[model samples]
Target: MATNGVHIIVSGRVQGVGFRWMTKMVAAKLHITGTVANQMDGSVEIYAVGASDQLAQFEAAVKASPTPSGRVSDYQATPLDPVPTFKNFDVIG
Candidate 1:
């Protein structure tokens, strides 16, 4: 299967709001393999890899912020060459 990747940077009340955990859950549900972390600049960064359709769903879910407490003001997803490294989604500090 052809795989794709995306580097996402989410801003606005993302950190300390369980955003990373929420992302992990969503990614796992979407079968996306990657990592989500809190950036030094008070934003959340995610690297996700999966099929194009799955990645699209993951992006939408991340933007929606499944957790009510988390608020995603803005986000940017950049396409990347898929690297077969991640075996599962994780929340990283």
Candidate 2:
């Protein structure tokens, strides 16, 4: 299976709610490699690289709001032409 990358932006009640941490946990479970961070705009940004099916599952998990306190109103995922390489998923920023 070919690997793929996605840049995801999650909006609404995501900051200060363990969203990034939860994202990291989810990524690990799905064997995804990348980073999740809290954006200045009260949104969460995630860059994930994994198998295509795993990427789809990751997207759904993200949209489902990994944290109980987090509410994902909008989830925008864009495919990356050149997939990023990361040793492991991390909670950044």
Candidate 3:
């Protein structure tokens, strides 16, 4: 299958709660390559590359809050044009 990419923004009680760590783990399991980072505005930003189905699954998984204490109030995913190259899923600062 061809690969696709998405840019996601997760809001609400996400930062400082292991959200990025859990996102990386989930992305790895789905064989997705991307980056998860905390935005200065209290949201979590994600850039993921994978199959379309996997990206949908990833969005669901992240919105459900895999981290013990994280709460995701909003999840928005936008299709990326010219998917960025990523070697692996990473938690970035």
Candidate 4:
């Protein structure tokens, strides 16, 4: 897909779960640079930048396993204006 800055919003049963932490771990393993956060609206928000192949890996990582108590109803991703300066992924609030 050759994505630039990839933004994703995963909905359903995500808040209060370990989604963000798990995302950080996978992102680190894949060398994805971005941020993952728990949205107030009970979803998980992810903003990551990397190669398209890596992004595919990232997407799979996100969907493969959520928290033990988490179940995703739907998730959407969009290509963002490239931000190539990012370095290392993190969990934000």
Candidate 5:
């Protein structure tokens, strides 16, 4: 399996909405390893590393479902040239 990575920034109504936790759940389900955190600017930032297809699926899911309380108005995902290493997915403050 070829490993890949992405850096995602989700904006709009994402804070205090379990977005990070939900992201962690999705990442775990996809066998992705990385971290999700609430940025100081009120956006959600995620760094995920996994298979290319899985990453695509993950991105799709995130955009498609912004959780019950969260409303994702916009998002940007950038492919990482050199993927980072992570043991598991986590939610960080």
Candidate 6:
């Protein structure tokens, strides 16, 4: 079965540690597509696309990981129309 793509923007203590790397690892493990990057507001934004179950798995992982020293709070998600172009999940600059 195919799942819809989900785009999320998380805000919190989300930069300058290992969060982005961790995100890449998690996404790779779950076979997701998109990128994770640090925003100017001191929060990390994760844009992901994949099956609903897989995206949910990444969500669960995000909720489970021990946030880095800079992390504070996570925002909500904004689901987007599926873009079937991301070949693999990555950490963007």
Most TM-score-accurate candidate: 2
Candidate 1 residue lDDT tens string, 1-93: 779989999898788777888888888788999899898999889999998899889998888885779888998988886465698898888
Instruction: Give the per-residue lDDT digits (tens) of candidate 4, residues 1-93.
Output: 454678899997777778888788888887789898888888888999987788789888787654677778888988887555577798997
Per-residue alpha-carbon lDDT of candidate 6 for residues 11-88, written as tens digits (9 for 90 to 100): 665676688888888888888888888778777777788878998898877765535554546667777764556877
Error of 5 at 10 (Å): 0.5
Query: Cα lDDT for residue 31, model 2?
Result: 98
Candidate 3 residue 62 Cα shift, in angstroms, is 0.8
TM-score of 1: 0.91
Local error of candidate 4 at residue 21 (angstroms): 0.4
Per model, state how many residue pairs clash: 0, 0, 0, 0, 0, 5
Which RMSD values do the candidates have, in order? 1.2, 0.7, 0.9, 2.2, 1.0, 2.0
Q: Where does candidate 2 stray beyond 4 Å?
A: none
Global lDDT for candidate 4? 0.80
Instruction: Tell me the deviation in Å of residue 77 in model 3.
Output: 1.1
Tell me which of candidates 1 and 6 scores higher on lDDT: 1
2 against 4, candidate with superior TM-score: 2
Q: Can you write out model 2's per-residue Cα lDDT over 1-93, one digit (the tens) per residue?
A: 999999999999899888888888889999999999888888888999999899899999899999999899998989988887999998888
Error of 3 at 79 (Å): 0.3
Superior candidate under lDDT, 3 versus 4: 3
Candidate 5's residue-wise lDDT over 19-78, tens digit each? 888888888889989999999999888999999899899998788654787788898999
Candidates' lDDT values, in order? 0.86, 0.91, 0.91, 0.80, 0.88, 0.75
State the local distance difference test value for candidate 6: 0.75
* Ranked candidates, highest lDDT first: 2, 3, 5, 1, 4, 6
